[model samples]
Target: MKITPLALAITLICVLAVLAGTTAPAVASDAGGIVGGIFGALIGTVREGEARNDWQKVNREVKTCLSKRINVSIGQLVQKAIDPTDPRLRPYMQACEQQVAEANAQLQQERRIAGLRREQEEAAKEAAAVRNAHARAQKVARHRELIAKYGAKIASDIEARRVRIGMTKEATIAAIGKPNSREVVPPSNELWSYGTKRIAFTNGKVTYVGN
Candidate 1:
């Protein structure tokens, strides 16, 4: 059965009371007629669905052990003046206690694994963000270096994608990016074509620009 938070809380209180010498009859009366109270409070809300399911398993297993060994239904135990510390109940209590311990341990291990998974995912996201930031910073630094070398006006022209006569071959190339093709003008010039636009370079400087 699904255990609610309030039910678990009440069970925990009852367990405390039982441990403090509360009689079996009193426990049965207050916490319902459950043998060993299923130790529901021992696990105590470790997680939501899975944890409750584990507690429910413990409850059923303990009650089953009690019913089989004592030959009495859980409901009958509540009406009888059953002693919580009865010698006949010892072996079953020990076995049921082991089950509770195992359930708690399993829940703890699952919680640790989930925490590790979350940490790994967060670390990966942080690493990717750092890489992107570094790439952007490098781009900004490269832009500044180009502006310093070519002067602001030339840089502005490059930014506007304008190629003009008297601009250095390097500067013109920077403005328009790489050309589609380059041709050797027989004597000492270079002809660079950019799709429909063409530029003529003489002695490493642009001499003419045309479509």
Candidate 2:
């Protein structure tokens, strides 16, 4: 008597159909035989494993409803049409109601999770934009400071690609802005490369410069 989402849907449909019938026949005595057509229609709407609609959340409450109303399985409904006055019908209806409620709760939980995920993605984007803007501002400020100290001659050296042996590391950086890479060449000697050009520093003073 597990009212799955599919079963819940079928039961809901069948209950509506039955109530609509005032004096419908209970068995397969005539062409309109019980809930057989109703079951068949539900089955036809999907393949064997898929749910017909979005009522998939009814699966969770198997403990609360299915543990008690165990015998009212899906296919058995065809053999006899439900009677409003029948002794078994009340429990079946109660179980169906519980399944519907559980399904609705599950749907709400999914929507909440989706909303939170979107909010997190938006926050991450804003943080990255702020970081990028700060970095750009810092670089611009450093360029202005370098130009103020060394004047237009250092700016021309930076633009025309030049590094001299007497320039300090900071002056070299002011001349070239920054290298693509730097490395130690043993015995406290540092080598900074800018494009194909290389500058060697020893004891914090430029020792060798070449392209």
Candidate 3:
């Protein structure tokens, strides 16, 4: 068979059309992959953002709950301390108040931790060492005074206060007068020492006391 120019041109056009049609789906598939990648990235970004927000919200709520508990404990300690009818129990009550103050101060320090976490989570590493040193120094001073003033009573009261660790410093002071001495716990900016008991304060609130 002899081919004419018109026939050749016609055959070329048909061949091109078939090739284009055959490859159309593959082209569409590649384009689809790009679009899917973009969509996936967007979804992941949204989910990560939401997770961060939820974490922060939960942390705040937990702190608030802890604060309320600390306050209630302090109030109870004050009530117990003021009841002169139980003179034997007064010392223990005073200790409880001090523990509460200490706890409140610790909580305040934790609030600082939270803030630091928000700014730079790594800050906790440095902050922890500083905090520990402060706690140790305060503990030493508190133990010395307790040994000097209350003697055996200090140990007994401390044990009792452990059972009731959420008293306020104000109530403790009201019950036992001013502290014989006071010292600051580092990093937390809380006070600690011994007079009649161990006490801790944070943001002017009593959070822990110990006999």
Sorting all predicted structures by lDDT, with the top scorer first, yields 1, 2, 3
- State the lDDT of candidate 3 residue by residue for 6-105, as single tens digits: 4554565555556656778876566556545655555555545554444344333433443364453322433333222246544544555566667778
- In terms of lDDT, the poorest run of 10 residues in model 1 is 42-51
Task: Give me the candidate number with maximum lDDT.
Answer: 1
Each prediction's TM-score versus the true structure:
0.43, 0.40, 0.21
Error of 3 at 27 (Å): 53
Residue 58 lDDT in candidate 3: 36
Question: For candidate 3, what's the RMSD?
Answer: 34.0
Lowest-sum lDDT 10-residue window in model 3: 77-86
The deviation in Å at residue 28 for candidate 1 is 36
Error of 3 at 161 (Å): 2.0
lDDT of 3: 0.55
All candidates' lDDT scores?
0.73, 0.64, 0.55
Tens digit of per-residue lDDT, candidate 2, span 1-211 = 6566567557666665656565556532332444556557555543333421212333435433543575653333322432223465557656667776878888999999999999999999999999999999997776677678766667556646577676678878756778899998788789889888888999877899888
Which stretches of model 1 miss by more than 4 angstroms? 1-76, 81-106, 156-167, 172-181, 193-199, 206-211
Give the per-residue lDDT of model 1 (tens digit) for 43-119: 33333344334334546767676677668875554334343445777787787768767987999999999999999
Q: 37, model 3: CA deviation in Å?
A: 49
